[model samples]
Target: MIRHLVLFKLNEGVAKDDQRALAGAEAFAELGSLIPELREWECGWNTTERDIAYDYAINSLVEDRESLQAYLTHPAHQAAAGQWREFATWVIADIEV
Candidate 1:
């Protein structure tokens, strides 16, 4: 199995409460049902107030690298990512588990 994790930080001058940020986060949360290649999906905004913490995160699981690739390349994922690209920067990790 593959575990795909993402950590997202809102860009400078963008507030967590901003409408664009909220919509982008909501879009990411909805991707689980929209993307067929995801076997599991969990994502949300961070509740903790910490300087080192990211504003949002995604934890997803897929069958294998191919499925992971499919999830990455999926049009729904692209649209959601595009929304985030406007207000945040993110990092990701893919692990075999």
Candidate 2:
């Protein structure tokens, strides 16, 4: 299995409750059902005041690298992820489990 993790930091002045942020969250929240290759899908805003903490995060799983690729390229996934591009920057890590 592959554990796919993404951490996001919203651009300056953007609040988590902003409509765009909410929309992105809603979109990602549905990905578990929308992407068949995803073995798991979990994402949410950060709940901390620490300066080092990212503003948001995604924790997901896939069966293998091929399945991970399928999830990454899926149209629904693309569309959902696009929402964040406008307001945030992120980092990702993938590990074989």
Candidate 3:
């Protein structure tokens, strides 16, 4: 399986409580149901207040690299990611397990 992880940081001047941020979070939350290639999905806003902490995170699992690629290029996933691209920067990592 491939474990795909993402950490998102809101851009400067964007507040965590902003409606756009909430909408972005909501969009990601729906991805599990929207995409079929995903074997597992988990995402949420960060509750901790720390300087180095990202504002949001996504942890997902897929069968293999092909599935992971499908998940990444899926239209639904692209749309959700577009929402976040407006006000956040993110990093991702994929691990084989």
Candidate 4:
């Protein structure tokens, strides 16, 4: 299996309530049902206030590297990522389980 994780930090002055951010987040929230390759999907805003904490995170599971790649390349994922790219930057890790 593969664990795909992503941490997102909004650019300076960007807020979660911004319409664009909301739309991006909503798009991501719908991905679990939209993509067939994902075995699991969870995403949300951070609840803690630590300085090092990312603003948002996505944790998903896939059967393997190929499944993970399919999720990454899915058009809905691409469109949602593009929306977030307008206001945030992120880091990702894909770990084999």
Candidate 5:
């Protein structure tokens, strides 16, 4: 299995507390249901706790590196990728499990 994780930081003045955070979370949470190749999808809001950071986080599971690559190249995902530029920052990592 492979784990794909991403943290997004929205542009200043665009995210008003939890509004954008919630919206983005909801969008990502629906991916597995909407895209069959996505084995799992999870989204979360960043907390103020001293040990936590990042505006929003998402984790997805795929079969392997190839499946992960296919997921990224899939049409549904390609469409969604168009929205990433609107965010101020994005961090991602993919690893085998």
Candidate 6:
């Protein structure tokens, strides 16, 4: 089993309280439901004044590296990618389990 975790920091131009942010979060959270290779997925906005570098965290479980790769390249994921590319400042990760 592998756990694929990703944390995202939104770009400065992206407004967290706006419609775009809400919709993007919704779309990203729903990717697990649409992608069969993803055994689990959970993500949400960060609500802390602690100067955290990232704004959200995505936790996913997959069978192995192959499944993890598939999840990474999945088309449903691509759709979400398009949005992330535009709004995200950067992504940090620690993939292990």
Candidate 4 stretches with Cα past 4 Å from truth are none
Assess the local accuracy of residue 7 in candidate 6 as a C-alpha lDDT between 0 and 100.
Answer: 79
Instruction: Specify the poorest-scoring 10-residue window by lDDT in model 2.
Output: 40-49
1-97, model 6: which lDDT tens digit per residue? Answer: 8888787887787778767777778889889789999888888877775675578778889988889889889888888867877778556454667
For candidate 4, write residues 27-90 as lDDT tens digits: 9999999999999999999998888999999999999888988998999999999999999999
Candidate 2 regions exceeding 4 Å error are none
TM-score for candidate 5, please give it: 0.76
- Estimate candidate 5's alpha-carbon lDDT, on a 0 to 1 scale: 0.71
Off by over 4 Å in 6: none
Candidate 4 local lDDT, residue 54 = 93
lDDT tens digits, residues 1-97, model 5? 9899988776766663545455555556666777766788887766754434677777899888778878888766765555545554788998888
Candidate 4 vs 6: which has more lDDT: 4
Give the lDDT of residue 4 in candidate 4.
Answer: 95
Check candidate 6 and list the clashing pairs. none
On a 0 to 100 scale, what is the lDDT of residue 76 in model 1?
88
Give the per-residue lDDT digits (tens) of candidate 2, residues 14-92: 9899999999999999999989999988998899989899999999999999999999999998998899999999999
Could you tell me the lDDT of residue 35 within candidate 3? 88
- Can you write out model 3's per-residue Cα lDDT over 43-93, one digit (the tens) per residue? 998899999999899999999999998999999899899999999999999
Backbone clash tally (model 1): 0
Indicate the residue-level lDDT of 72 in model 6.
83
Q: Count the backbone clashes (under 3 Å) in each candidate.
A: 0, 0, 0, 0, 0, 0
Q: Weakest 10 consecutive residues, lDDT, candidate 6?
A: 87-96
